[model samples]
Target: MNREMLIKLWQAHKNDEWPHVETGQEGPLMTLDTVISGCVVYVLDGEEDLDEQRRAIVSDCLAELDTLEIEINDECRSYFGRLREIGTLLLITT
Candidate 1:
């Protein structure tokens, strides 16, 4: 991610602020819990398989989570781990 994206990501994820939603199934959509996971979802964007560029972006976003220093609860930890698994394939195949 570039500096601008990093800035936006930090802004969105800062203070553990949740996304504002008037109506949605928050219970089932754990991806929205953090900006990084949300970026994973956006990169996937309903794709059935991961492409190289998409994979890198997702991987970078997941790795970027570490620098954020936010507490990862059980739910987000599981979600992020799953995303990492999906992107890790890029390391071998790319």
Candidate 2:
């Protein structure tokens, strides 16, 4: 994930502008999940390939995601599961 995108996501999260589930579109949530998943892949593939600064941004983004208050409805279960898995992998590998 690029720094600009992370910053945008962070800003959107801070503004409570994401998680568009109420609109019947889980796009923003999906985007966040994808970005985090990508981070995990990159971290596993080669942590050295990612810029140190970008790694910090990713870490901060994941931390921010950790603070999110998502409802555990059926629609969100898979996403949350993957998020938790990603978080665990990050904790173990990073």
Leading candidate by TM-score: 2
Tens-digit lDDT track for model 1 on 1-94?
A: 2333433443444435443332433432344234335443554454334466656665665565453325555545544444344334333333
TM-score, cand. 2 vs. native:
0.48
Question: Mind sharing the TM-score for model 1?
Answer: 0.35
Task: Please give the RMSD to the true structure for each candidate, in Å.
Answer: 12.6, 10.3
For candidate 2, the 10 contiguous residues with the lowest summed lDDT are 11-20
The lDDT values for all models are 0.44, 0.52
Please, what are the lDDT tens digits per residue for candidate 2 over residues 1-94? 4433434443343344333354433554565566766765565456434556656655665665565535436655545544655544454445
Task: List TM-scores for all candidates, in order.
Answer: 0.35, 0.48
Off by over 4 Å in 2: 1-25, 47-51, 67-69
What clash count goes with each model? Answer: 0, 0
Q: In candidate 2, which residue pairs get closer than 3 Å at backbone N, Cα or C atoms, i.e. clash?
A: none
